[model samples]
Target: MIAERLSLQLPHTKVDPRILSALVCGSALALLALKWTRQRRLQQKLEEARRKREHALMEMRTMSLQFKEQNPSVQLEAILSLPLTELVEKLREGSLSPESVLYTYMGKALEVTHEVNCLTDFLPECVAQLQDLKKQKQRGPLYSVPISIKEHYDYKGHNSSCGLAYFLGTLAQEDSVVVQVLKKQGAIPFVKTNVPQSMFNFDCSNPIFGQTLNPHNHKKTPGGSSGGEGALIGGGGAILGFGSDIAGSIRVPSSFCGICGIKPTEGRLSLCGISSPVYGIKSVHPAIGPMARDVDSLALCMKALLCDHMFHLDPTVPPIPFRDEVYCSTEPLRIGYYDTDGFTLLPPCMKRAVQETKKLLEKAGHTLIPFNPLRMEYVVGELFLKGLFPEGASALLEKFEGDLIDPNLKPQLSVYKLPQLLKRILAFFLRPVVPRIAGELKALCGIGSAKNLWKQHAAAEVYCQEFIAEWKKLRLDVVLCPVMGPAFNLGYLGKLVASGTYTVLYNILNFPAGVVPVTNVTEKDEEELRHYKGHYNDHWDKLIKKAAAGGVGLPVGVQCVALPWQEELCLRFMKEVETLTREKSRSTIGPRIEAL
Candidate 1:
């Protein structure tokens, strides 16, 4: 009886197949509708942001025109032509008022932005800031000087979106520590400039603000992620601006735009309130520095920024103030110079710029020693890439999810987003063909475990030690080298990101480095560029050659580097190079290239 009861089965009822099909179709429709709604909302936000920016620009232009009409004696051209130092002098001596300088720069910036699309948002709060500054009895070093900043720097009540639609509506609750220090020093930040999405790529383009073109040649990129600051200064719209660097952000832009910019030692200024693309990476640190038309302007900004106020506002920053003696010293330096890093070959113009600068400095009584960077490919792979993103591209890619990706970033993102197994296979096959890229690909494929991440970071520390030991052995006060560009064509960085080794090497060492415009690309430089097949003769090398074409008359710059916490000395080196370059251009007989 128990077995018979256990074997008993229940009767089943059947449902309509048509009902099941209808339910499935309805569920698919619901999902499609949800996706459409989300995309529509994002599009509306993007349009709204564009409208806001345009409106702000219109208001600024209108205000500037009214000021111009009201003050006919303000000579906009003459004032705009003055360098930062002269402008500051005029302001101090009461020959020019703060309002005139502000209006002049605002009008000029508007003109430049129209041509280059560099600016994102004009600061209306500038009027209030100027009013406040007028009440101060003791004027700051940058008194009444208008400055532009990279978009990610926090300004109280403004958005600091790093060119992503996801972050459009968020407002910065307080000023970035650097901004706070600038305000105290009487520098008015009148505009925020555009940046590449996530501030990851070296070329400046984003879905929200669009692309920022090189002012000198619209077909070329001005270099990024500090590109806007470079364009603004390079175009004579602003005398000085602030930009931050992690890799080659500041110096590359400076090189491409023919402006001067410095990347200070990590934490030399302040990073508090700047919206970094990736956080919690301990291997490399991002730094804040100034960009300007002339080296003196950069030095002046540094002097103002490295003050008690900056130290007080950000306790994490080293409290050392700018040393006047170090910047102003007349002492000759033991300068080490290199044209290439051995991983990637620089264009002929870039190499010539380095060689020429070395000759100039040597003539000025500084000793020039040849220096070769050690294991640059390894440093870029393990230290720069893996060290900066130990967990891989997930952190950066997640930021762009649901947001429109810039075309310039797609190639780079695709490389990092490959499947782990696929990445290994590609690396294995690519090792002999393009070893540099293979090494980088292997590093970018996320560290599989915490133990591996720790090992990578330790390796970075060891590499730094080796680099420092080499530097000490050379006994060099400064190093002179080629900066990565005379500006490449737009969108090429997606395929040639590793070309930044010339500048990234310094960032990895956390050294203070500056870029000074040394010369303009000559016709011969472009002619020689045709033969540039890099060491590997790979696809990347061909891409670099193509990117560098049509760059004649573009400005070329070189890097000046010093040890950590030696920002003052770095600036001095840059200033020396700038002065010598100017004198060479003015002389009937230029410095002979083959004299050395």
Candidate 2:
């Protein structure tokens, strides 16, 4: 009876199992097709958004050009010349709102970026923050102030490429410590500036973002790795910005662009969450600092950054409070002045700036004493190359593995590919005969290995101590020297990259330094180069020739340095120089303008 029932049911289903299987397969295929169609549509939307964003940027660029053309006077004036401080005060008093200030800066930023490629990421959040501040009535010292950051610093949801294309699309999970501090202080970060690829080269160029040119002269570099910040601030786009310096990264750009930048002592500022190609190696000091048009703005930013809460964000920094007495004092200080580093001499323009600055300081009743750096050639030449690649520069160069390196950096990076064993053997053999040979050996193969790394570190420590001891012996409060030879032409940097010895030496010693403009290039200064005879060193002579030949109308700058954690002193010296220069200019120009 059961078999009969089964047979009847089976026969009724002469709708075959094959037919049922086909129906199931058809359903599965339909679902997959629907999913594929949805995915395609989503991808199309993403592509469309990307295109629209690009189009918007293009439109912004065009508008920037039109705006600049319509308003010519805006290009020559610094952002500090604007009513930013007044606007902030008014915003606090409810007489003005954050939206007005944000709009003004954003428009100005767009205009500046068109003339100079200063921004890497433009901030849309700034507008939103302005609206929020207006609604909440939040009051902070930096409220409604527009700030720009270096690309190396992290900003949540933005790329901290540090000028590498490989890291492009790698969004930061959170803001860097400095960014958080700035945001909490009510400063609106309106843009992220460009940097040298890997933040190594003094000349700012990378495969991802081209090069940042000096606003004073577009053909020449603005200097790097804080070059974009320097260019932006110098162009009057940013009132204040963040910059990091290891080896003249901040100071060089500041000098090249005719602005003020402070390179604080290592660990004085928080470095947490700041990304870079080379991270753990610390033979040379790298610190984050402020770049601005004036020293006071730098002081304002520095005071904001050195608040007690910063120590909580990064335990590595000492809990030293910002000393108001150090910056605000009017007491006379002893300053050391040197026209040359003994290895590479300064050009006539730089030499004249140094001379003029020394005289200005003297007139102000500050003691100016001649100070010769002890063994500056041996120290800077050896330690700079040694500390540059303590763990072997191979890893640093690897970041640019498939990318095109800037022409100016090729000479330096070329040394990274040499065989390690050969370099060691050469160093061992040449140690007795030639001192610089060891540096050359390390440069050729890149210095690595536990023994070599420790040896380099030890040497760096010894040098730092000895340098400080000498400074103590000299009883000096500050040292003034040329930042580099006369401002180099665009492509001429490759020939004189070694001129950085004067600046990089301070980096090795971890001293705080500031660059202040002394004077612009003059015909008299240019003519002095023709009769000059360099130190007779082949490399030095060649560099001098390249610098002097046809580099007539560039700006010249000088550096003021103080001991570790003495950023306040360094800035004080800078302000002194600025004041002296202004006084001299007024005395010189008063009669001419009055006669006109």
Candidate 1 lDDT, 1-596, residue by residue in tens: 74355456422534468988998999999999999998999899999999999999999999999999999988899999999999999898889999999999999999999999999998999999999889889999989999999999999888889988878999999999999999999999999998988888899999998999999999999999999998988998888898989888999999999999999999898899998767887778689899999988888999999898988888888889889899999999999989988888988999999998899889999999999999987888888888777777888888888888899999999988898788889999989988877887898887779898888778877887888888889898999998889899988987886798888888878899999998998999998999889877788888899999999999999999999999999999999999999998867344454453
Task: Indicate the residue-level lDDT of 89 in model 2.
Answer: 70
**Per-residue lDDT of candidate 2, residues 1-596 (tens digit):** 96588678786645568978998999999999988886665446435433543554565455445645666555333334654455457657866445544545667776777787777777666767766766655577787788899988998887787876556668899999989888877889978888877888777776556677888887777888898998898888888888998888888889888888889998999989789888776777888898887787787778878876688888889988778799888999999989887776767788789998998899889998898877765565457766677656776877875455667667666656567787778777876665344546655454557787787789888878887787888899999988874546665554454568778888888899989887888888778877776664455466566655565567678899998888888888888898889789899999999999
The candidate scoring highest on lDDT is 1
> Estimated TM-score per prediction?
0.96, 0.84
Worst 10 residues of 2 by lDDT: 75-84
Alpha-carbon local distance difference test for all models: 0.90, 0.76
On TM-score, the candidate that comes out on top is: 1
lDDT of 1 at 149: 92
Off by over 4 Å in 1: 1-11, 589-596
